[model samples]
Target: MTDTGQAEQAGGLSVVTTATDGIRVLTLAGEIDHHTGDQLRHALEVTGTARPRIVIDMLRVTFMDSSGINILVNAHQTVTEADGWLRLAAPTDSVLRVLQLVGIDDVIQCRPTLREALAL
Candidate 1:
């Protein structure tokens, strides 16, 4: 277990934030698409400021569109530029499929669990 942040729910998704050992984790739920991509991007932007070692727990993310992928890819670039990294944790089967299709799984680190992502 790690230090956890307060949880908040939004229109298309919910974010449960946590951080420990210099890593920040965002547990996400619901759909991620064009309509909600900006919001998610904004939340992730804050992580980029403090430390871009971000782990996005996507266990509850039922769906993701290209917009979601765009935001995540951009975040990865930012994190990498800052000497940090981004990880995607426990994405749903469908979401993982999309990521694989786009070769994003190769570009970004994907972990089986939040704990695993944090450990990395």
Candidate 2:
């Protein structure tokens, strides 16, 4: 898991990375707001630069605001420009609602599970 130093502190959002067969999965937890969104973006941008298949497992994320959504949208464009794709996996109901409300859920694929995201 690639530990972005910021998430290491207490109660900070954590971005853990694991890759298999060139598919990188970033497991995110805790709040991803204005403060932590940069950490998430950095991790995704770094991984997105190398791998085409990127799955973001948000099953454990407690809260995500507009900043977090913006990061994902930017990441989506980054991956797609490389002929790759980004999938958001297993978001909580609250997060899912926000995504749907903004129509991002339609633009960016949101899988029911990490396994499902990886499978595609």
Candidate 3:
């Protein structure tokens, strides 16, 4: 596993990136609102990889708004178009509720643990 270090921080959000095998794991902490949406989007952007497999660990995310939802939806679409997949891991109750309410959980896979998200 290789740590990509801290990828971005804006407002109350912090994103740390790491890679194992070919999958990129983004561990996020703090709130994800309009102010932090760009940071999250940037962290999700695929660079060299053709089919970027990504897992977003949201265990520490305390809050999220429509902006965050939009970012996630856009990122999911982008990756899916590239034949990649994006998964959400261990989101808190509040975040999971939001995802479920918005039907994001239906669109993007949400795993109960990081290990599950990382699994094929």
- The TM-score-based order of candidates, best leading, equals 3, 1, 2
- Give candidate 2 regions above 4 Å deviation: 1-11, 47-51
Q: What's the lDDT for all of these models?
A: 0.86, 0.83, 0.93
Clashes of 2: 0
Choose 1 or 3, whichever is better by TM-score: 3
Q: By lDDT, highest first, what's the ranking? A: 3, 1, 2
Per-residue alpha-carbon lDDT of model 3 for 21-111, expressed as tens digits?
Answer: 8899999999999888888988888877898899999999999999999999999999999999999999999999999999999999999
RMSD (CA, angstroms), candidate 2: 3.0
Q: Model 2, range 1-115, lDDT digits (tens) per residue?
A: 4443433423478887788567778888898999887788778874425448789999998888999889999989989888888999999999999899899999899998888
TM-score of each: 0.89, 0.87, 0.96
Q: In candidate 1, how many Å is residue 64 off?
A: 0.4
In terms of lDDT, which candidate is strongest? Answer: 3
